[model samples]
Target: MAGLLQRVKSKMAIFAHRKARGMLDGEYGSVFRGRSLDFDDLRAYVPGDEVRDIDWKASARHGSPLIKRYVAVRRQTVLLVTDTGRNMAAEARSGEVKKDIAVLALGVLGYLAHRHGDLVGLVCGDSAATRSLPAKGGEAHLERLLKHVDSHANLEAAASRIQDQLHHVARNVKGRHLLFVVADEIAADAATGQLLRRLRAQHEILWLTVRDAELAPSRQAGTDPIARGDSFSVADSTFLAWQPATSAAVQAAYTKATAERDAARKAMLRGAGITEGEVAGSADVITGLFALLERHRRAG
Candidate 1:
Protein backbone atom coordinates (compact mmCIF):
# COMPACT_ATOMS: atom_id res chain seq x y z
CA MET A 1 0.00 0.00 0.00
CA ALA A 2 2.82 2.41 0.84
CA GLY A 3 4.53 1.71 -2.48
CA LEU A 4 1.27 2.25 -4.35
CA LEU A 5 0.80 5.58 -2.55
CA GLN A 6 4.33 6.66 -3.44
CA ARG A 7 3.74 5.87 -7.11
CA VAL A 8 0.50 7.86 -7.10
CA LYS A 9 2.26 10.82 -5.48
CA SER A 10 5.05 10.75 -8.06
CA LYS A 11 2.59 10.73 -10.96
CA MET A 12 0.56 13.53 -9.39
CA ALA A 13 3.66 15.66 -8.86
CA ILE A 14 4.56 15.42 -12.55
CA PHE A 15 1.01 16.24 -13.63
CA ALA A 16 0.84 19.22 -11.27
CA HIS A 17 4.21 20.52 -12.44
CA ARG A 18 3.06 20.55 -16.07
CA LYS A 19 -0.34 22.01 -15.27
CA ALA A 20 1.15 24.73 -13.07
CA ARG A 21 3.57 25.75 -15.80
CA GLY A 22 0.74 26.26 -18.29
CA MET A 23 -1.18 28.27 -15.74
CA LEU A 24 1.82 30.46 -14.90
CA ASP A 25 2.21 31.35 -18.59
CA GLY A 26 -0.96 33.43 -18.16
CA GLU A 27 -3.78 31.62 -19.89
CA TYR A 28 -6.71 33.76 -20.92
CA GLY A 29 -8.86 34.83 -17.95
CA SER A 30 -6.22 33.61 -15.53
CA VAL A 31 -5.90 35.79 -12.43
CA PHE A 32 -2.49 37.35 -12.92
CA ARG A 33 -3.22 40.26 -10.64
CA GLY A 34 -4.32 39.70 -7.10
CA ARG A 35 -7.79 40.54 -5.80
CA SER A 36 -6.72 44.12 -5.16
CA LEU A 37 -5.81 45.86 -8.38
CA ASP A 38 -3.47 48.84 -8.25
CA PHE A 39 -3.26 49.23 -12.02
CA ASP A 40 -5.35 48.43 -15.08
CA ASP A 41 -4.95 48.86 -18.87
CA LEU A 42 -3.59 52.03 -20.43
CA ARG A 43 -6.26 54.17 -22.00
CA ALA A 44 -6.54 57.59 -23.59
CA TYR A 45 -6.59 60.35 -20.95
CA VAL A 46 -10.13 61.64 -20.35
CA PRO A 47 -10.93 65.20 -19.30
CA GLY A 48 -11.92 64.11 -15.75
CA ASP A 49 -9.12 61.48 -15.34
CA GLU A 50 -6.16 62.06 -13.01
CA VAL A 51 -3.10 63.57 -14.75
CA ARG A 52 -0.49 61.51 -12.84
CA ASP A 53 -1.10 58.40 -15.00
CA ILE A 54 -0.41 60.14 -18.32
CA ASP A 55 2.65 58.85 -20.23
CA TRP A 56 4.29 61.99 -21.67
CA LYS A 57 6.78 60.12 -23.89
CA ALA A 58 4.01 57.99 -25.48
CA SER A 59 1.89 61.10 -25.94
CA ALA A 60 4.81 62.87 -27.69
CA ARG A 61 5.49 59.83 -29.94
CA HIS A 62 1.80 59.63 -30.88
CA GLY A 63 1.61 63.40 -31.64
CA SER A 64 -2.00 63.69 -30.40
CA PRO A 65 -2.41 60.52 -28.30
CA LEU A 66 -2.59 60.58 -24.47
CA ILE A 67 -1.50 57.38 -22.69
CA LYS A 68 -2.29 56.42 -19.11
CA ARG A 69 -0.43 53.67 -17.21
CA TYR A 70 -2.04 51.42 -14.61
CA VAL A 71 -0.67 49.17 -11.86
CA ALA A 72 -1.37 45.46 -11.13
CA VAL A 73 -3.86 44.23 -8.56
CA ARG A 74 -3.43 42.16 -5.42
CA ARG A 75 -4.01 38.38 -5.59
CA GLN A 76 -6.67 36.24 -3.93
CA THR A 77 -5.99 33.36 -1.54
CA VAL A 78 -7.19 29.76 -1.95
CA LEU A 79 -7.98 27.36 0.86
CA LEU A 80 -8.31 23.60 0.43
CA VAL A 81 -10.09 21.56 3.08
CA THR A 82 -9.86 17.77 2.99
CA ASP A 83 -11.72 15.31 5.20
CA THR A 84 -9.54 12.45 6.42
CA GLY A 85 -12.34 10.91 8.40
CA ARG A 86 -13.01 7.19 8.54
CA ASN A 87 -15.76 7.61 5.97
CA MET A 88 -13.08 8.46 3.43
CA ALA A 89 -11.64 4.97 3.79
CA ALA A 90 -14.77 3.45 2.28
CA GLU A 91 -14.01 1.37 -0.81
CA ALA A 92 -15.63 1.88 -4.16
CA ARG A 93 -15.64 -1.30 -6.23
CA SER A 94 -12.18 -2.91 -6.39
CA GLY A 95 -10.07 0.17 -7.03
CA GLU A 96 -8.42 3.05 -5.16
CA VAL A 97 -10.07 4.22 -1.96
CA LYS A 98 -11.87 7.56 -1.59
CA LYS A 99 -9.06 8.87 0.63
CA ASP A 100 -6.54 8.30 -2.16
CA ILE A 101 -8.67 10.18 -4.67
CA ALA A 102 -9.17 13.09 -2.26
CA VAL A 103 -5.41 13.40 -1.69
CA LEU A 104 -4.71 13.57 -5.43
CA ALA A 105 -7.44 16.14 -6.02
CA LEU A 106 -6.15 18.36 -3.22
CA GLY A 107 -2.60 18.05 -4.49
CA VAL A 108 -3.55 19.20 -7.98
CA LEU A 109 -5.60 22.14 -6.73
CA GLY A 110 -2.83 23.22 -4.36
CA TYR A 111 -0.29 23.18 -7.14
CA LEU A 112 -2.57 25.03 -9.54
CA ALA A 113 -3.39 27.73 -7.01
CA HIS A 114 0.25 28.20 -6.10
CA ARG A 115 1.18 28.46 -9.75
CA HIS A 116 -1.47 31.12 -10.27
CA GLY A 117 0.17 33.17 -7.48
CA ASP A 118 -2.57 32.57 -4.96
CA LEU A 119 -1.76 31.97 -1.32
CA VAL A 120 -2.76 28.41 -0.42
CA GLY A 121 -3.62 26.69 2.89
CA LEU A 122 -4.86 23.27 3.95
CA VAL A 123 -7.31 22.28 6.67
CA CYS A 124 -7.72 18.58 7.44
CA GLY A 125 -10.40 17.39 9.79
CA ASP A 126 -13.19 15.03 10.81
CA SER A 127 -15.04 16.22 13.95
CA ALA A 128 -12.02 18.22 15.04
CA ALA A 129 -9.74 20.13 12.69
CA THR A 130 -5.98 20.21 12.13
CA ARG A 131 -4.38 23.07 10.28
CA SER A 132 -1.54 21.39 8.48
CA LEU A 133 -0.25 24.39 6.58
CA PRO A 134 -1.12 28.09 6.42
CA ALA A 135 -1.68 30.12 3.27
CA LYS A 136 1.64 30.72 1.49
CA GLY A 137 2.96 31.17 -2.04
CA GLY A 138 5.69 29.82 -4.37
CA GLU A 139 6.69 26.38 -5.64
CA ALA A 140 8.53 25.54 -2.41
CA HIS A 141 5.41 26.23 -0.34
CA LEU A 142 3.35 24.03 -2.65
CA GLU A 143 5.86 21.22 -2.38
CA ARG A 144 5.82 21.45 1.40
CA LEU A 145 2.02 21.31 1.46
CA LEU A 146 2.04 18.20 -0.75
CA LYS A 147 4.53 16.56 1.55
CA HIS A 148 2.29 17.17 4.54
CA VAL A 149 -0.64 15.66 2.72
CA ASP A 150 1.48 12.67 1.79
CA SER A 151 2.70 12.11 5.35
CA HIS A 152 -0.80 12.24 6.83
CA ALA A 153 -1.74 8.73 7.89
CA ASN A 154 -4.10 9.09 10.82
CA LEU A 155 -7.82 8.57 10.23
CA GLU A 156 -10.60 10.31 12.10
CA ALA A 157 -12.62 8.44 14.68
CA ALA A 158 -15.86 6.78 13.63
CA ALA A 159 -18.88 9.12 13.80
CA SER A 160 -16.65 12.17 13.38
CA ARG A 161 -18.52 15.32 12.35
CA ILE A 162 -17.39 18.07 9.97
CA GLN A 163 -19.80 20.93 10.67
CA ASP A 164 -18.00 22.47 13.62
CA GLN A 165 -14.63 22.21 11.98
CA LEU A 166 -15.95 23.84 8.82
CA HIS A 167 -17.36 26.73 10.80
CA HIS A 168 -14.04 27.20 12.49
CA VAL A 169 -12.30 27.31 9.15
CA ALA A 170 -14.67 29.98 7.94
CA ARG A 171 -13.98 32.12 10.97
CA ASN A 172 -10.21 31.73 10.79
CA VAL A 173 -9.74 32.64 7.12
CA LYS A 174 -9.28 36.42 7.26
CA GLY A 175 -9.99 37.41 3.69
CA ARG A 176 -12.26 36.45 0.82
CA HIS A 177 -10.81 33.34 -0.85
CA LEU A 178 -11.68 30.31 -2.94
CA LEU A 179 -12.52 27.35 -0.71
CA PHE A 180 -12.26 23.85 -2.17
CA VAL A 181 -13.65 21.00 -0.08
CA VAL A 182 -12.98 17.31 -0.73
CA ALA A 183 -15.26 14.81 1.01
CA ASP A 184 -18.05 12.31 0.60
CA GLU A 185 -21.58 13.59 -0.07
CA ILE A 186 -22.86 12.56 3.29
CA ALA A 187 -26.15 14.09 4.40
CA ALA A 188 -25.75 17.67 5.64
CA ASP A 189 -27.15 18.23 9.06
CA ALA A 190 -28.53 21.62 10.12
CA ALA A 191 -25.20 22.73 11.50
CA THR A 192 -23.48 21.77 8.30
CA GLY A 193 -26.00 23.76 6.29
CA GLN A 194 -25.52 26.85 8.45
CA LEU A 195 -21.74 26.61 8.23
CA LEU A 196 -21.86 26.29 4.47
CA ARG A 197 -24.19 29.24 4.12
CA ARG A 198 -21.91 31.45 6.19
CA LEU A 199 -18.81 30.43 4.26
CA ARG A 200 -20.49 30.74 0.85
CA ALA A 201 -21.41 34.36 1.53
CA GLN A 202 -17.73 35.25 1.87
CA HIS A 203 -15.95 32.77 -0.40
CA GLU A 204 -16.38 30.77 -3.58
CA ILE A 205 -16.92 27.19 -2.43
CA LEU A 206 -16.43 24.09 -4.62
CA TRP A 207 -17.06 20.57 -3.39
CA LEU A 208 -15.26 17.48 -4.70
CA THR A 209 -17.15 14.37 -3.63
CA VAL A 210 -15.32 11.04 -3.56
CA ARG A 211 -17.55 8.02 -3.88
CA ASP A 212 -17.09 4.28 -4.39
CA ALA A 213 -18.85 2.66 -7.38
CA GLU A 214 -19.84 -0.26 -5.18
CA LEU A 215 -21.42 2.18 -2.74
CA ALA A 216 -23.39 3.65 -5.61
CA PRO A 217 -24.52 0.30 -7.02
CA SER A 218 -24.76 -1.23 -3.52
CA ARG A 219 -24.48 -4.89 -4.41
CA GLN A 220 -21.91 -7.57 -5.12
CA ALA A 221 -23.87 -10.29 -6.86
CA GLY A 222 -22.54 -13.65 -8.15
CA THR A 223 -19.25 -13.31 -6.23
CA ASP A 224 -18.46 -16.40 -4.24
CA PRO A 225 -17.97 -15.95 -0.49
CA ILE A 226 -14.53 -16.57 0.99
CA ALA A 227 -13.98 -20.07 2.42
CA ARG A 228 -13.08 -20.67 6.08
CA GLY A 229 -9.42 -21.18 5.13
CA ASP A 230 -9.22 -17.91 3.19
CA SER A 231 -7.32 -15.13 4.92
CA PHE A 232 -7.75 -11.36 4.78
CA SER A 233 -6.26 -8.42 6.66
CA VAL A 234 -8.17 -5.96 8.82
CA ALA A 235 -6.31 -3.12 10.52
CA ASP A 236 -2.73 -4.42 10.23
CA SER A 237 -3.23 -8.13 10.95
CA THR A 238 -4.34 -11.08 8.87
CA PHE A 239 -7.27 -13.22 9.95
CA LEU A 240 -9.33 -16.09 8.55
CA ALA A 241 -12.99 -15.64 7.79
CA TRP A 242 -15.42 -18.45 8.68
CA GLN A 243 -18.33 -17.09 6.67
CA PRO A 244 -19.24 -14.24 4.34
CA ALA A 245 -22.63 -13.26 2.94
CA THR A 246 -23.35 -15.02 -0.38
CA SER A 247 -27.11 -14.61 -0.72
CA ALA A 248 -28.33 -12.79 -3.83
CA ALA A 249 -31.24 -11.27 -1.93
CA VAL A 250 -28.87 -9.84 0.64
CA GLN A 251 -26.80 -8.23 -2.12
CA ALA A 252 -29.96 -6.82 -3.74
CA ALA A 253 -31.04 -5.23 -0.46
CA TYR A 254 -27.62 -3.68 0.01
CA THR A 255 -27.80 -2.24 -3.48
CA LYS A 256 -31.16 -0.61 -2.87
CA ALA A 257 -30.00 0.95 0.38
CA THR A 258 -26.87 2.40 -1.26
CA ALA A 259 -28.86 3.93 -4.12
CA GLU A 260 -31.19 5.65 -1.69
CA ARG A 261 -28.23 6.97 0.28
CA ASP A 262 -26.61 8.40 -2.80
CA ALA A 263 -29.81 10.17 -3.87
CA ALA A 264 -30.19 11.79 -0.48
CA ARG A 265 -26.57 12.87 -0.49
CA LYS A 266 -26.92 14.57 -3.87
CA ALA A 267 -30.05 16.41 -2.80
CA MET A 268 -28.38 17.65 0.34
CA LEU A 269 -25.41 19.00 -1.58
CA ARG A 270 -27.71 20.89 -3.94
CA GLY A 271 -29.54 22.43 -1.04
CA ALA A 272 -26.23 23.67 0.41
CA GLY A 273 -25.57 25.54 -2.85
CA ILE A 274 -22.44 23.51 -3.55
CA THR A 275 -21.60 21.95 -6.90
CA GLU A 276 -20.31 18.42 -6.45
CA GLY A 277 -17.91 16.37 -8.60
CA GLU A 278 -18.20 12.66 -7.98
CA VAL A 279 -14.97 10.69 -8.32
CA ALA A 280 -14.57 6.92 -8.20
CA GLY A 281 -11.09 5.62 -7.45
CA SER A 282 -8.45 7.10 -9.76
CA ALA A 283 -10.96 7.97 -12.50
CA ASP A 284 -9.92 11.12 -14.43
CA VAL A 285 -9.72 13.62 -11.56
CA ILE A 286 -7.87 16.21 -13.62
CA THR A 287 -10.48 16.34 -16.36
CA GLY A 288 -13.34 16.86 -13.94
CA LEU A 289 -11.36 19.41 -11.91
CA PHE A 290 -10.31 21.38 -14.98
CA ALA A 291 -13.88 21.46 -16.24
CA LEU A 292 -15.06 22.79 -12.89
CA LEU A 293 -12.36 25.46 -12.79
CA GLU A 294 -13.18 26.51 -16.35
CA ARG A 295 -16.85 26.81 -15.50
CA HIS A 296 -16.06 28.94 -12.46
CA ARG A 297 -13.64 31.10 -14.43
CA ARG A 298 -16.23 31.71 -17.13
CA ALA A 299 -18.87 32.57 -14.59
CA GLY A 300 -16.58 34.96 -12.72
Candidate 2:
Protein backbone atom coordinates (compact mmCIF):
# COMPACT_ATOMS: atom_id res chain seq x y z
CA MET A 1 0.00 0.00 0.00
CA ALA A 2 1.10 3.54 -0.64
CA GLY A 3 2.31 5.31 2.49
CA LEU A 4 -0.34 7.49 4.17
CA LEU A 5 1.93 10.45 4.89
CA GLN A 6 3.03 10.45 1.26
CA ARG A 7 -0.61 10.79 0.23
CA VAL A 8 -1.03 13.79 2.52
CA LYS A 9 2.06 15.40 1.02
CA SER A 10 0.72 14.85 -2.47
CA LYS A 11 -2.54 16.58 -1.61
CA MET A 12 -0.60 19.50 -0.09
CA ALA A 13 1.61 19.72 -3.17
CA ILE A 14 -1.48 20.09 -5.30
CA PHE A 15 -2.83 22.74 -2.92
CA ALA A 16 0.49 24.64 -2.93
CA HIS A 17 -0.21 25.50 -6.56
CA ARG A 18 -3.24 27.58 -5.60
CA LYS A 19 -1.67 29.19 -2.51
CA ALA A 20 1.89 29.63 -1.36
CA ARG A 21 3.02 26.77 0.88
CA GLY A 22 4.29 29.23 3.44
CA MET A 23 0.80 30.67 3.90
CA LEU A 24 -0.41 27.39 5.37
CA ASP A 25 2.62 27.18 7.61
CA GLY A 26 2.14 30.78 8.66
CA GLU A 27 -1.50 30.21 9.48
CA TYR A 28 -0.59 27.18 11.56
CA GLY A 29 2.16 29.08 13.35
CA SER A 30 -0.11 31.99 14.25
CA VAL A 31 -2.45 29.71 16.20
CA PHE A 32 -0.11 29.65 19.18
CA ARG A 33 -0.12 32.87 21.22
CA GLY A 34 3.30 32.23 22.71
CA ARG A 35 5.99 34.58 21.39
CA SER A 36 9.67 35.14 22.00
CA LEU A 37 11.47 38.38 22.86
CA ASP A 38 13.69 37.99 19.83
CA PHE A 39 12.26 39.96 16.94
CA ASP A 40 12.14 38.38 13.52
CA ASP A 41 10.67 41.08 11.27
CA LEU A 42 7.59 43.17 10.68
CA ARG A 43 4.87 42.35 8.17
CA ALA A 44 1.65 43.99 7.06
CA TYR A 45 -1.12 43.18 9.50
CA VAL A 46 -3.70 40.73 8.19
CA PRO A 47 -7.28 40.48 9.46
CA GLY A 48 -6.51 37.57 11.74
CA ASP A 49 -3.15 38.85 13.01
CA GLU A 50 -3.14 39.50 16.73
CA VAL A 51 -3.61 43.17 17.55
CA ARG A 52 -1.15 42.87 20.41
CA ASP A 53 1.61 42.24 17.89
CA ILE A 54 1.01 45.59 16.21
CA ASP A 55 3.76 48.19 16.63
CA TRP A 56 2.00 51.52 17.20
CA LYS A 57 5.02 53.69 16.41
CA ALA A 58 5.92 51.62 13.37
CA SER A 59 2.32 51.70 12.16
CA ALA A 60 2.17 55.46 12.60
CA ARG A 61 5.42 55.97 10.70
CA HIS A 62 4.54 53.51 7.95
CA GLY A 63 0.93 54.78 7.66
CA SER A 64 -0.29 51.19 7.87
CA PRO A 65 -0.72 48.44 10.38
CA LEU A 66 2.25 46.14 10.76
CA ILE A 67 2.81 43.24 13.14
CA LYS A 68 6.06 42.43 14.85
CA ARG A 69 7.10 38.90 14.08
CA TYR A 70 9.18 36.95 16.53
CA VAL A 71 11.27 33.84 16.37
CA ALA A 72 9.70 30.97 18.36
CA VAL A 73 11.84 30.22 21.39
CA ARG A 74 10.23 26.95 22.32
CA ARG A 75 9.06 23.89 20.45
CA GLN A 76 5.31 23.41 20.92
CA THR A 77 3.50 20.11 21.04
CA VAL A 78 0.49 19.33 18.80
CA LEU A 79 -1.73 16.50 19.97
CA LEU A 80 -3.99 15.07 17.24
CA VAL A 81 -7.27 13.89 18.79
CA THR A 82 -9.70 11.75 16.81
CA ASP A 83 -12.51 9.19 17.08
CA THR A 84 -11.68 5.71 15.78
CA GLY A 85 -15.02 4.06 16.33
CA ARG A 86 -17.19 2.26 13.78
CA ASN A 87 -18.95 5.55 13.06
CA MET A 88 -15.75 6.77 11.40
CA ALA A 89 -15.79 3.70 9.22
CA ALA A 90 -19.06 4.92 7.63
CA GLU A 91 -19.35 7.02 4.48
CA ALA A 92 -18.84 10.76 4.43
CA ARG A 93 -20.94 13.33 2.58
CA SER A 94 -18.74 12.86 -0.48
CA GLY A 95 -19.23 9.08 -0.43
CA GLU A 96 -15.68 8.46 0.73
CA VAL A 97 -15.07 6.47 3.89
CA LYS A 98 -15.02 8.77 6.91
CA LYS A 99 -11.91 7.17 8.38
CA ASP A 100 -10.01 7.91 5.17
CA ILE A 101 -10.89 11.57 5.49
CA ALA A 102 -9.94 11.49 9.16
CA VAL A 103 -6.55 10.00 8.36
CA LEU A 104 -5.90 12.60 5.66
CA ALA A 105 -6.81 15.46 8.00
CA LEU A 106 -4.62 14.10 10.79
CA GLY A 107 -1.69 13.48 8.42
CA VAL A 108 -1.78 16.97 6.96
CA LEU A 109 -1.68 18.63 10.39
CA GLY A 110 0.96 16.18 11.63
CA TYR A 111 3.18 16.94 8.62
CA LEU A 112 2.80 20.67 9.20
CA ALA A 113 3.86 20.17 12.82
CA HIS A 114 6.79 18.04 11.65
CA ARG A 115 7.92 20.80 9.30
CA HIS A 116 7.57 23.35 12.09
CA GLY A 117 9.92 21.35 14.35
CA ASP A 118 7.23 20.60 16.93
CA LEU A 119 6.41 17.38 18.66
CA VAL A 120 3.33 15.48 17.38
CA GLY A 121 1.33 13.02 19.44
CA LEU A 122 -2.01 11.24 19.04
CA VAL A 123 -5.05 10.54 21.23
CA CYS A 124 -7.68 8.38 19.55
CA GLY A 125 -10.00 5.50 20.29
CA ASP A 126 -13.56 4.20 20.55
CA SER A 127 -15.87 4.04 23.57
CA ALA A 128 -14.14 0.90 24.75
CA ALA A 129 -10.82 2.58 25.35
CA THR A 130 -8.75 5.70 24.74
CA ARG A 131 -5.13 5.47 23.58
CA SER A 132 -2.28 7.92 23.49
CA LEU A 133 1.11 8.10 21.84
CA PRO A 134 3.84 10.12 23.56
CA ALA A 135 4.70 13.38 21.85
CA LYS A 136 7.75 13.00 19.64
CA GLY A 137 9.41 14.42 16.55
CA GLY A 138 10.17 12.90 13.12
CA GLU A 139 8.20 11.86 10.02
CA ALA A 140 8.57 8.16 10.83
CA HIS A 141 6.78 8.53 14.15
CA LEU A 142 4.06 10.57 12.49
CA GLU A 143 3.67 7.94 9.82
CA ARG A 144 3.23 5.36 12.54
CA LEU A 145 0.55 7.47 14.18
CA LEU A 146 -1.36 7.77 10.93
CA LYS A 147 -1.05 4.07 10.31
CA HIS A 148 -2.41 3.26 13.72
CA VAL A 149 -5.51 5.37 13.13
CA ASP A 150 -6.09 3.95 9.65
CA SER A 151 -5.74 0.35 10.73
CA HIS A 152 -7.77 0.44 13.92
CA ALA A 153 -10.92 2.36 12.91
CA ASN A 154 -13.20 -0.16 11.24
CA LEU A 155 -16.80 -1.37 11.07
CA GLU A 156 -16.20 -3.68 13.99
CA ALA A 157 -14.80 -1.08 16.32
CA ALA A 158 -16.79 0.20 19.30
CA ALA A 159 -19.11 3.20 19.20
CA SER A 160 -17.66 6.72 19.30
CA ARG A 161 -17.60 8.81 22.46
CA ILE A 162 -15.36 11.83 21.87
CA GLN A 163 -15.95 13.00 25.43
CA ASP A 164 -13.97 10.05 26.69
CA GLN A 165 -10.91 11.12 24.76
CA LEU A 166 -11.29 14.70 25.98
CA HIS A 167 -11.56 13.47 29.55
CA HIS A 168 -8.33 11.53 29.04
CA VAL A 169 -6.55 14.67 27.97
CA ALA A 170 -8.00 16.65 30.86
CA ARG A 171 -7.04 14.08 33.47
CA ASN A 172 -3.76 12.63 32.20
CA VAL A 173 -2.06 15.13 29.89
CA LYS A 174 0.02 17.92 31.37
CA GLY A 175 1.35 21.25 30.12
CA ARG A 176 -0.01 23.53 27.42
CA HIS A 177 -0.34 21.97 23.97
CA LEU A 178 -2.04 22.66 20.67
CA LEU A 179 -4.90 20.18 20.29
CA PHE A 180 -6.13 19.50 16.73
CA VAL A 181 -9.31 17.40 16.93
CA VAL A 182 -10.92 15.58 13.97
CA ALA A 183 -14.13 13.67 14.37
CA ASP A 184 -17.68 13.26 13.11
CA GLU A 185 -20.61 15.49 14.04
CA ILE A 186 -20.83 15.16 17.82
CA ALA A 187 -24.06 15.87 19.62
CA ALA A 188 -23.87 18.76 22.07
CA ASP A 189 -24.50 18.13 25.77
CA ALA A 190 -23.96 19.90 29.07
CA ALA A 191 -21.17 17.65 30.27
CA THR A 192 -19.40 17.87 26.90
CA GLY A 193 -19.68 21.64 26.94
CA GLN A 194 -18.23 21.84 30.46
CA LEU A 195 -15.36 19.54 29.53
CA LEU A 196 -14.58 21.63 26.43
CA ARG A 197 -14.47 24.83 28.50
CA ARG A 198 -11.98 23.28 30.91
CA LEU A 199 -9.77 22.06 28.11
CA ARG A 200 -10.00 25.39 26.27
CA ALA A 201 -8.61 27.10 29.37
CA GLN A 202 -5.54 24.87 29.28
CA HIS A 203 -4.81 24.29 25.58
CA GLU A 204 -5.29 25.88 22.19
CA ILE A 205 -7.86 23.78 20.32
CA LEU A 206 -8.91 23.55 16.66
CA TRP A 207 -11.70 21.27 15.47
CA LEU A 208 -12.44 19.55 12.14
CA THR A 209 -15.79 17.80 11.71
CA VAL A 210 -16.19 15.16 9.03
CA ARG A 211 -19.61 15.69 7.49
CA ASP A 212 -22.00 12.78 7.46
CA ALA A 213 -23.51 11.43 4.23
CA GLU A 214 -26.58 13.15 2.87
CA LEU A 215 -29.60 11.01 3.54
CA ALA A 216 -31.97 13.16 1.55
CA PRO A 217 -31.48 13.98 -2.11
CA SER A 218 -29.79 17.24 -2.93
CA ARG A 219 -30.71 19.51 -5.86
CA GLN A 220 -28.35 17.52 -8.01
CA ALA A 221 -30.61 14.78 -9.32
CA GLY A 222 -29.77 11.16 -8.54
CA THR A 223 -26.20 11.94 -7.59
CA ASP A 224 -26.23 10.22 -4.23
CA PRO A 225 -26.29 6.47 -4.65
CA ILE A 226 -26.11 6.02 -0.93
CA ALA A 227 -29.28 7.98 -0.53
CA ARG A 228 -31.07 6.08 -3.26
CA GLY A 229 -30.51 2.78 -1.49
CA ASP A 230 -31.32 1.82 2.06
CA SER A 231 -29.02 3.42 4.60
CA PHE A 232 -27.90 1.80 7.81
CA SER A 233 -26.39 3.42 10.83
CA VAL A 234 -22.80 2.40 11.46
CA ALA A 235 -23.33 2.49 15.19
CA ASP A 236 -26.17 -0.02 15.31
CA SER A 237 -27.06 -1.01 11.75
CA THR A 238 -30.40 0.73 12.27
CA PHE A 239 -32.23 1.73 9.08
CA LEU A 240 -31.74 5.41 8.38
CA ALA A 241 -32.85 5.97 4.79
CA TRP A 242 -35.02 4.44 2.09
CA GLN A 243 -36.89 5.48 -1.05
CA PRO A 244 -40.15 6.06 0.78
CA ALA A 245 -38.36 8.04 3.46
CA THR A 246 -37.15 10.47 0.78
CA SER A 247 -40.58 12.06 0.48
CA ALA A 248 -40.57 15.85 0.38
CA ALA A 249 -41.97 16.15 3.90
CA VAL A 250 -39.44 13.69 5.26
CA GLN A 251 -36.60 15.53 3.54
CA ALA A 252 -37.85 18.82 4.92
CA ALA A 253 -38.00 17.45 8.44
CA TYR A 254 -34.56 15.88 8.10
CA THR A 255 -33.18 19.15 6.83
CA LYS A 256 -34.67 21.06 9.75
CA ALA A 257 -33.32 18.62 12.31
CA THR A 258 -29.87 18.58 10.72
CA ALA A 259 -29.70 22.36 10.69
CA GLU A 260 -30.68 22.67 14.34
CA ARG A 261 -28.17 19.98 15.32
CA ASP A 262 -25.36 21.71 13.45
CA ALA A 263 -26.27 25.07 14.95
CA ALA A 264 -26.17 23.63 18.45
CA ARG A 265 -22.83 22.02 17.79
CA LYS A 266 -21.38 25.28 16.49
CA ALA A 267 -22.74 27.16 19.48
CA MET A 268 -21.15 24.71 21.88
CA LEU A 269 -17.73 25.05 20.28
CA ARG A 270 -17.97 28.82 20.07
CA GLY A 271 -18.93 29.00 23.73
CA ALA A 272 -15.81 27.03 24.56
CA GLY A 273 -13.68 29.35 22.41
CA ILE A 274 -12.73 26.66 19.89
CA THR A 275 -12.60 27.34 16.16
CA GLU A 276 -14.13 24.69 13.94
CA GLY A 277 -13.96 23.57 10.29
CA GLU A 278 -15.80 20.94 8.31
CA VAL A 279 -14.76 18.58 5.53
CA ALA A 280 -17.06 16.32 3.52
CA GLY A 281 -14.26 14.30 1.99
CA SER A 282 -10.54 14.10 1.43
CA ALA A 283 -10.72 16.56 -1.47
CA ASP A 284 -11.74 19.45 0.78
CA VAL A 285 -9.39 18.57 3.66
CA ILE A 286 -6.64 21.06 2.76
CA THR A 287 -8.94 23.97 2.10
CA GLY A 288 -11.08 23.20 5.10
CA LEU A 289 -8.02 23.14 7.35
CA PHE A 290 -6.66 26.38 5.94
CA ALA A 291 -9.94 28.10 6.74
CA LEU A 292 -9.98 26.48 10.17
CA LEU A 293 -6.50 27.74 10.98
CA GLU A 294 -7.33 31.19 9.72
CA ARG A 295 -10.43 31.24 11.91
CA HIS A 296 -8.41 30.10 14.91
CA ARG A 297 -5.95 32.95 14.35
CA ARG A 298 -8.80 35.44 14.16
CA ALA A 299 -10.74 34.05 17.11
CA GLY A 300 -10.49 35.82 20.49
> Which candidate leads in TM-score?
2
Give lDDT per model, in order.
Answer: 0.62, 0.89
lDDT of 2 by residue, 1-300 (tens): 779999888888886664666788888877775532358999999999989899999999999999999886578889999999999999899999999999999999999999889999999999999999999999999999999999989999999988899999999999888899999999999899999999999888999999999875333346464554556788898865366555988878978999999999999999999999999998898889889999888874
Task: Give the local distance difference test score of model 1.
Answer: 0.62
Models 1 onward score TM values of 0.66, 0.83
- Please give the lDDT score at residue 74 for candidate 1: 54
Positional deviation of 81 in candidate 2, in angstroms? 0.3
lDDT of 1 at 9: 50
Please provide, for model 1 over 1-300, each residue's C-alpha lDDT reduced to its tens digit, 9 standing for 90 to 100: 444334445756555577653552343125332333444556677787767657788788877557555565456677888766655665544366666777777776776665566788877766545555788887666666655654552443343345645766877777667788887656646666667878877777777777654412214334443432233332333443323335567568867887888777667666666656666656566666766565555544
